[model samples]
Target: MIYKALGGDGAAATVVTAAGDARPGPAVELHDPLELLVPDTEDDYRLTVDPDTGHLGFTSTTEAPYAILKADPYLGARRKQTIPDPAFVVAHHGGPAILERTASVLGCDHRQLRHSWDSLRSQGNMTSVSVLDVLARTLDDPDGPRPGEEGLMLAIGPGVTVEAARLRRT
Candidate 1:
């Protein structure tokens, strides 16, 4: 699905899975403020507020930069996974700010990150399908990254698990 989405002509492109592992579980539960919570005296669970702060979100300002800084090691590790000098990066579409921050940390240009934002803007968040959607858009673009270029594909899911792959355009 990802290969086809990324304009694999069925002639050459290759997708190689990197690491796949599930974390134990989240120590905290994220809650929506608008949702009512039943009062529970038995269980002690920390309910974290949704990070989405709407128009006044910290993503555009402080949080994203801090996150990028904190994620440097992880990014470096991903880069070290045998895929050298990837020219493109396809990540799960969180939001424009987060995507921009990720691209900045990855040393990707605005044009490379635009397809993910385009997918977000045009179709909203498609959850698990978001990265594929972005890949489809990238493949559809005439001026998108081309053959011989290497790329990295990544997605973060529940349990703070990440799925990543290395690809070489054919």
Candidate 2:
């Protein structure tokens, strides 16, 4: 029941263009997008299809939460090495616990992640669109990143992959 409650359906879209493209009102300049598959944890989280019904399903092993928790060290290291002190954080709505842990590692206060929490509450976990949904919400937020401010986006996926990107509002 708890797991089911954490899931929700949603869809979102965004515009992407080259650096030299014409400005579309305001835009986010993307930088340093990194996707890293955590070693030895590939099977921790997975998607499966029911053979009889052909319905897709999600599964996680007992080690899944622990494996995810272990990402804090990597997150911290990356923060120090490359990630800027972002004014906003648009992250996947994995769950409240995961969101809390991510904020802790990234040194983000609750306000910085308010949009992510709101997205999770209203839309559950929308898989691929989760972060995009959060980003959309962030863009509409009155307190969201201002022009010239930096933002960070984060997501975890099937391969136990951690993807991070730097976004600057322009």
**Backbone clashes, candidate 2:** 0
Question: What TM-score against the true fold does each predicted structure earn?
Answer: 0.55, 0.85
In candidate 1, which residue ranges exceed 4 Å CA deviation?
1-70
Q: Across residues 1-170, which tens digit of lDDT does each residue of candidate 1 receive?
A: 32223222313232433224323321111111111122321122121234574321111223322344345566666566545566776776666666776776677777767778787788765655787777766666678667666777765433233456665555
What value of lDDT does candidate 1 attain over all alpha carbons?
Answer: 0.53
Q: In model 2, how large is the Cα lDDT of residue 162?
A: 89
lDDT of 2 by residue, 75-131 (tens): 777766666577888888687887887787788899888998998898778777899
lDDT of 2 at 101: 77
- Native-to-model Cα distance after best TM-score fit, residue 80 in candidate 1, in Å: 4.5
lDDT of 2: 0.78
Enumerate clash totals for all models, in the order shown.
0, 0
Give RMSD (Å) of candidate 1 vs. truth: 14.6
Lowest summed lDDT window (length 10), candidate 2: 1-10
